[model samples]
Target: MNLALFFDPLADEAPAWGSTTLGAHAARFVDTFPDWRSADLALIGLNEWRGSAAGQPAASAPDAVRQRFYQLQRGTGPCRLVDLGNLRNGLTLEDTYLRLREIVAALLEHNTVPVLLGGSHDLDIGQFLAYETLDRPVSLSCVDARVDMAEEAGAHAEDTHLRRLLMHEPNFLFNFGQLGHQQYLVPTSVLAALEKLHFETLRLGEIRADVRQAEPLLRQADLVSFDLTALRWPEFPGYLPASPFGLTAEEAAQLCWYAGHNDQLTSIGLYGYRPDHDLLGLGAATAATMLWYFVEGYYHRRNETDFTSRRFIRYAVGLPGNPAKLVFYKAKRTEKWWMEVESLADSSVRRIVPCSYQDYLRAAQGDLPNRWILTQALLG
Candidate 1:
């Protein structure tokens, strides 16, 4: 596919001499967009903002975020990155969505990760659609201040996009998780609906207490859609209906780092940025830094998944009344933990999922860990 037809090449002039600026190292499809099927990472900016209730203009966010992102220092490791420029908005919102879905699907087919710079939270629906186009069963994670499931009359797409995603036909979603959601801002009915589906929802308080607790949750996601409003106003002043409380800037970056390390994750969309509302580009800088850390983690990925490898240490503990033993595997290299879930219909078929050291301790105490129970429930 000729991606150039769908995108406008980045036309920003490189800043004056700097040894460490990303513009010096990262490859860009500026003058002429190239065939990016072989690149390790590809960035595409979504300029459409019609989904936002704030009434922001369409197709203006990609470059705003890029101005800050391209100025940051590049990492030491080899990063085969390409900037595909901003996507051109279609005549209708639906048309814009279809264009995004096609672009994301193509990137995933070539084993390239797509990092999307967004216009609003609703753009995530398109990102979710890409996974369906590939016919891959996936788990989705959202970082937002409120559940975007509100279905109201004359609401913007951001308000009801998740509703559509959840009800879409030919459902292939294996799991769904939400992080950093402010309880008071979300409706009780929405929370109840998610609970009925056995979906995971981590409140802001839970995440703030210990950020590492979010790693395993993020690891399960194949695609992550981060709503910038999840950050407190002091840190991200560009988000609408800005709240006084949300994730710290550091915590937001940490979550992105976790997403980058996951071998299962294929795409990430950073949404809810409005440059017009920003306080002297603070929001843009924060978003860019988060993107930097994500890319840094990506380059550091170990890509180790096989439990059968000799590099893994296996542990088995017998529960008091259970006939079968609970098994866990810890990687010798990264020291990450994974628990095995046997298929009830076929014992030979077992799936390994990310777990914590605490889960191992719980299993050793003859208690059924929640992670294990949840995985089993989802598998069923």
Candidate 2:
């Protein structure tokens, strides 16, 4: 698998030089990662917007520099050009999504794990669709400061990406690191819609207070989508409805690392790397570090467990003195995983599932065994 799949959709002037669009930091992220022997890295260059998410086709040089880029990435990486530019090839929404679905399907079918460097976060819609085709269902985890699920109140274009994604299908999503949500900017009806659904959002305040607290919610995630705008000011400045509260660069890296540790996670994508807003290469550099942690975390998790699927099981430590209440949750396969949320009223006694941590940690889904139910009563 190529480590660095570089795609430059902004050909106007080229960010500044060396991935100027993503910023100098992006170049550094690419260069430094290879030094440590991370996964193989491939840079796929694409012509400027031939099509926006709206599918507006633009121009490209069939024989231009991008053509050379396309050729170089073919045999060099885990899969074809990580296909970063959407509009450059797809002139309309359907056109883009269709091409993306095929491209993503091929990579995943062959188990070529991809780390998407998107032209715009909207490109994420294609990535999502690709995995939806998989026989095994996948979980989506978003790390951003804003809840991008707002509807297009007549506004069109790339801005409405998250809004479109939520409406497509019923998929498991975990929105992490959201902050700076302004009522004037995002409609409450949209938030209400999300509530009607069963997705969960972890706000910035909660994470800043304690990152570890979110671990239980993320343990079973398979794919992680990161929007750079979630970082606090000075670290990331371009977020919509920019907020003063957000994760620090170090925090983002740690979060990515933890995400990597999730045995079920398979892919990651980093978006919104606009060099124009980032004069220096700080943002790209930060992103590179975050990616590095993801790699490290994955490696660590891989080493911690035996390869035999039967030996590895999900693990969890319930909050002390909670309740025996249980809620069933689903995993990728026939396995069973459950969540127990109980009120500790004076903390007389409460017991949830009683099983080996090794066993319960790995259970993805199913009804609790009769013995487990009896154990809750015994402990209570």
Candidate 3:
């Protein structure tokens, strides 16, 4: 697939550089698009908002984000990054979706992480579809204020996009989680529906209390779709549905850092940015800083997937009344934790899932961790 056919060169003027702006350090595939075969991370921009919910705010979000993002200094280790410029919109919303899915699949096939600058949160349907075509079972983590599972309601497709993703045939979704959801913004029925599927949800207050608790959930995700509307309006007033109570800017950046550190995570869509509503471009700056932290975390990756590594310490605990023993692996290199759940059907197949110190503490107290039960049920 010739991706150049669907993209345009970056039109934002050259950002003023002090000693080291990221734009100056990074190689971009703009103007004359270059071969991305060797790139580790490829950035793509989507400027369309046709599928946004009613009262769609006017948005040229890609450029607005880029203007601020390019001005930041490069802080990560040497990285082969390329900006694929902005994706051209199709005549219809469905066509645009198809184009995006195809592009994302192509990038993934080449082992390049695709960081999407999105138009609307609904555009995540296309990102999710790419994984389906790749024939990979994926765990999706969505950071949004609302559940967005309502039956086709208003003009904004954001309200129905999650439903579309869940209902799509050949469903390859292994798990789904919603982070930073506000209780008042979500319907009771929507919560019930997700519970029926064994999906997970974390309320905004829960996250605000201890954002680190979100790491395990984010770690399990193969892809993440973040809506800028999840940020408080005072910190980031860049889109419709701007709320008085949502994640603070620092908390939002922390989540992005978590996403970047997730070894399983491959694709990420930063969506729901509307440049029209931004106050003195503060929203753009906040979004750019979040992206910067993501990149930083990406570089700090510990490559600690192998539990057998000498850096890992094994701990075994006996549970009271339960015949099965719980096993945990702690990575001394990164201080990360993982719990092993042997498949009931296939003893040889053991699943090591991300866990927290709290889970280990619970097991030591002869308690079966809820996460362990959830994993067992899913495997069964």
TM-score of each: 0.96, 0.59, 0.95
Cα misplacement distance, residue 190 of candidate 2 (Å) = 3.3
Q: Where is model 2 more than 4 Å wrong at Cα?
A: 1-88, 169-187, 237-243, 303-380
Q: Report every candidate's CA lDDT.
A: 0.86, 0.48, 0.85
Task: Name the Cα RMSD for model 3.
Answer: 1.7
Clashing pairs in 1: 47-59
lDDT (10s digit) by residue, model 1, range 1-380: 87789998777576663767876766777787866798888998887877877776533666778788888888856878888888898898899999999999999999999999977788888889999876767899999888988778898898899888888889999888889998998999999998878788889999999888899889888999999889999998886666899998999999999999888899999988888778588988899999998998888888778789898999998988642689999989888888997766667766788888889999988997887777777777
Candidate 1 TM-score, true structure as reference: 0.96
Better of 1 and 2 by TM-score: 1
Residue 293 in candidate 3, Cα distance off native in Å? 0.8
Task: Give one digit per residue, the lDDT tens place, for model 2 in 200-317.
Answer: 4566667777776455445545666676767875886533345666688888888877776677665666665554444454655566566556655655564222323554343444
Write candidate 3's Cα lDDT for 272-321 as tens digits: 88888886999999999998888877888888888887999999999875
lDDT measured at residue 232 in model 2 versus the true structure, 0 to 100: 72
- Total clashing pairs in model 1: 1
Give the per-residue Cα lDDT of candidate 1 at 22: 78
